[model samples]
Target chain A: MRAVAVGQAELKLFWRNRTALFNSLLMPLLLVPVLIAVDASGVPLVIGLVGFALLMAVYYNLVTTFVARREELVLKRLRVGELTDPEILVGAALPSVVIALGQMVLYCLVVAVVTGVDLPSRPWFLLLGVLGGVAIFVLLAAASSAFTRTVEMAQVTSLPILMACLFGSGMMFPLTNLPEVLAKVLQYLPLTPVLQLLNAAWADGPVIKPLTVVAVWIVLGTYAVQKWFRWDPRR
Target chain B: MTAIEVRGLTRRYSGGFEAVRGVSFEVERGEMFALLGTNGAGKTSTVEVVEGLSRPAEGTVRVLGHDPFAERAQVRPRMGVMLQEGGFPPDLTAFEAARMWAGTLTSPRPVDEALEMVDLTHRATVRVKQLSGGERRRLDLALALLGKPEVLFLDEPTTGLDPESRRNTWELIRALLREGVTVLLTTHYLEEAQALADRLAIMHRGRIVAQGTVSEVVDAYPSRISFVPPAGVTLPFVVDAEPSGRVTLRTNSLQSSLHELLAWAHLNNVELSGLDARSASLEEAFLAIAEEAA
Candidate 1:
């Protein structure tokens, strides 16, 4: 309940920041449609782009919310109350995480209906990918804010994943396209395995290949990000 | 009984800064205790540890008989804290924020009642972002009171408040005390401390210089009577007489001392000027102590 309350409060603030919402939602509309022009024929292209939009609308935007709260000393203030550390953090992350989940579902629906993007062979693989991708990225975003000096720095701090998921989160090119060695390396990048799991699930490819790989990234990414997260803004 | 008992509390930051070096104090139940200190004097560090937001680098802090760091769950639900910076989310209406906090407590005061206590019922629907600085502080205090907490920690609660707002906050706190709520407030405003605290501890650097009732602590210093001297009309030798003005003398005694000086002065050539006597207040005592510590 505490976590829900915190998340709900964060969600309200997230909606109120008009510029952030416009950029996270509408700005992507213009570019994604244009970007989707090149490979409208392939279902993988649409799935990948939808994944990118989820990361944009949900994952990336949530980072700024937590970053702004920490900068404002909201997290520190919340800590002084009855809330435990986990309660405070989980509550803070809940709103964005829920939004990310909703956006992913919406994106999946939009692609399936409009572009006739087919369903995944292994539904569990895509489900794991969606949940795991959000989990890993939320932690990574928090960890990223430790280095971010201000909310403005959130844009720059998030660029690495923004670009990586573009080329690496498996939302852009399939890891299979690169040289065997490089493909294997890119497959292990933070979003690579999750995106691949999603892609594999969507295409009904052998589920085991992406599932085993994606699971490792999720576990490893979640561990690394939580261990390194800094809730207090240094000023 | 002690509502707050801190023993050898120490807080050493990661950058080799020992902000609080073994500081400790106690606040009796239902007493208004003030933690008085200047900026960067380890006050914030010590208070954070007490609020259970940070662990002490050494020693123990117990609020209402529960260790704040080790037994946070026990202390947390029973206490309310208002930190240096107000923490209410800006988008929520004041009423919503109060109600949300009320949901977290085991035995909370009604949301409307808490708002009414702070005189913020009129602004219940106002968005937190829309509130003025003083209104926001009242809201922060309102949230702290939502739980009807037994122990309330207010750090600089009146920092940005106007005189009227500060007085209102003082009255609200006084009412809480009347209802037997234990308050631990930190403020640099000596008058605020003097007005509210039944007992207070003055901090210099990371150590307490004095701790007691205001009258007891302030009366530890010298009381003085200052009056214009009757030229060449002083009788009886005075111990610590400071006469700097053209004809002014500050003496340790007010009654008998004033009478003797006046009688002698009347027989002589000068008339006593602007006679006034005062005991050192907590403010005077605090400034004197801080200067010496500096």
Candidate 2:
């Protein structure tokens, strides 16, 4: 309940900053639409939308929240209170995670209505994919934040992961079309299991092989968070 | 029970530079105690250990009779802290931050009440980023005052305040002290220590060099009179003559010293330049101790 209240205020603050809202939302709406127009087959369209969710919900939210808090020293201050260490971190991230979740839902709904695509058949895989994606990105963001000395550094810090996800996550090209060696290598990338799970979950028969891979990635991401997340401003 | 007790509290950074050198002190309940030092004196490190923010590498710290590091929850709800870093979330409004802090405590003062206490009620709606430096300090104070904390840890709470704001904060602190709140304050400002602290410790080179009641420590040093002996003539008392040609008399009795000086000066038919009598001030004791430690 407390996290939700904080999340609501965070969302309001995000909205108040018009330019941040534009950067966070515009990339998805415009990029996905352009991809849909180019393909016209709609398969690439849905994949592009899912990719957008991963970027904003998990990657962007995580990085921005981490950098902002670090610069402000908010995490250090929160540690002195009654809140436990985990609670302090998780609570601060809750707001961004919630925003990410809301954006994903809204994106999916908009894509469905405009493109005439139905909801996923199995839904469980997509559900797990989105939730697991959120967890993965949130953790990765914290890990990435360790390298980020300042909020101005966040843009550069986030670029590598963004580029890696764009090419390696099979959003630009179908995973089945990739060379077997490359496909196997990319399988370990954090976004691969998420996209694979979403794709499998959306298919008529429902493939669940991505479940194990995603679970492993979740563990890896969480380990990184535990090991590298910095609570204090170094300077 | 001691509000705070530290034993061999030392903190060494990862680079092997020791910040706090096994310093320890106990803050009795319901009194204002200050840790005095210039910047980089490790006063912050000592207090942060007591506040349960940093784990001292070698020492043990107890607040309310529970180890702060091992038993954070046990001490957290009972104490309030304003750290050296005024780390406020930029997105948080003053009221929201206060309310969120209030939620953390099992028992807390109402958010508005805390704000009102710090004179931040008018600016409660403003986002933290919009606040002035001193306003942010008040917001920090408001957070520290939440839970009507039994013990408060304040690390340079008046750093950026104007004189009016500083005086107001002092008055507010006095009110809290009257209500029996145990306060532990840290500051570089000497006047702040004299005005508010009943007891204080001065730290230098990561160790406390002096700790006692204001008068107790000062009384240990001789009260002094600084003056230029008129016409370079000798005075009755033994004087520590300075390079500046000003004579300092280290007298045990201030009243008798003053009496003797006035009588002698009248009989000698000379008036001294810049005659100033000082009963051993806390500032003098602070300088002496810090200089000795350094």
Candidate 3:
């Protein structure tokens, strides 16, 4: 209940910042046109857009949000209240999660209209992939914020993951296009399983292997956040 | 009943720097206790421990009979804290910030009432980043009061306020005290402590060097009498003289010392120039502690 309150305030603040809003909401849409121009179609194109939305709106935005709140001492002040550490974090992340999910929905609709593709055969897998991706990315963002000393440093600290997910997670290009050995290696990257789950939503593919991978990343991400997330600003 | 208790509380940072060392004090229910200290005196560190923001490195702190750090949920709802710095989100308006904070409390006062208490109703629509420093401080106070907490912890609550706002804040605090709220305040303002604290502990270099009522702390230091001595006239009592030919006498007995000096001037038919005598004040005592620690 308290988390909802925190989330409401965060949503207001999120909307108030024009630059952040533009970056999170509009910037990722630009990639949709580029993907279309590159002749990417069907499940891969929709999955790519979903991955971009999560990365830009949820992961990147959350990293900066956490770092800025810590430096501003917002997290410290909130701790003085009844909210626990997890409650505070979840509440703060609520706006970005909602935004990313909204973007995912919009992207799916746009792709469906543009490509004249039918609805997914297994919508459950799509839902699971999207929800699981949100949880994993939220935790990863919090954990990444541990290394980010300032809001400016967020750009630097978030780069490695952003690059890894972009190039290796089958977001920009499909794994099938790469060599067999390299494709197998890249499949284990954090976002790859989420993409695999997403692809399975539209067509038949292996589920248990990708499901196990997603579960493993979620566990590791949760552990990392618990172990390293900082509430106070580093002096 | 004791509202707060600390025993041998020590706090150390990651690099082994002890910010607060072996400090202990208690405040009874419906009483105000101030922690006075110089910069780097560990007052904030000690208060943070009691507020359950951090665990003590060496001792225990219990607020309202519960370990504040270990059992925060039991204690936090009953206490309010105004940190030394306002950590409000800059993008939030004063009203929005207060409303949001109120949402987190189990039974918060109305947002309008909190804003009115801090005289921030006029600035409710202004973003925090746009507010003046004093306004920001008042907003911090407003949020702290939203929870209607039983025990309030204020760390330098009036640091950046204008004189009028400072006085108004004092009145608000006094009103809270009158209503039986327990307050634990940490401040660099000696006069504020003297005015508000029922009892205070003076800390220097991470330890309490003195703890007593205001008069008691002031009484520890001697009163002063200073004047320019008439040339070649040996004074009746020993004194410390500066190069400017001014002599100062420190004495616990202010009346007797002044009388003795007046008598000597009359007997010698000598006139004393620039004569000044005053009893010790909290400021004097505070400066003395800082010097002694130095």
TM-score of each: 0.92, 0.93, 0.96
What DockQ does predicted model 2 obtain? 0.59
TM-score for predicted model 1 compared with the true structure: 0.92
On lDDT, the stronger of 2 and 3 is: 3
**Candidate 1 lDDT for residue B217:** 85
What local lDDT score does residue B84 receive in model 1, on the 0 to 100 scale?
Answer: 83
Ranking according to TM-score, highest score first: 3, 2, 1
Best by lDDT: 3
Q: What are the DockQ scores of the candidates, in order?
A: 0.59, 0.59, 0.81
| Model 1: colliding residue pairs | B229-B247
Q: What are the Cα lDDT values of the candidates? A: 0.76, 0.80, 0.91
Sliding window of 10 residues with minimal summed lDDT for model 2 chain A: A1-10
- For residues A160-200, what per-residue lDDT tens digits would candidate 2 score against the true structure? 88888877888877666889998888877778878887777
Superposed Cα deviation of residue A157, candidate 1 (Å): 1.1
For model 2, name the residue pairs that clash. Answer: none
Tell me the interface RMSD of model 3, in angstroms.
0.9
Looking at model 1 chain B, report the run of 10 residues with the lowest lDDT sum. Answer: B245-254
Model 1, B152-205: lDDT tens digits are 999999988989889999998998999999999999999999999999998989
Query: Chain B TM-score, candidate 2?
Result: 0.92
lDDT of 1 at A62: 64
The residue-level lDDT of candidate 1 at A73 comes to 73
Cα-lDDT of candidate 1: 0.76
* Model 1, residue B58: C-alpha shift (Å): 1.5
Ten-residue segment with the worst summed lDDT in candidate 1 chain A?
Answer: A33-42
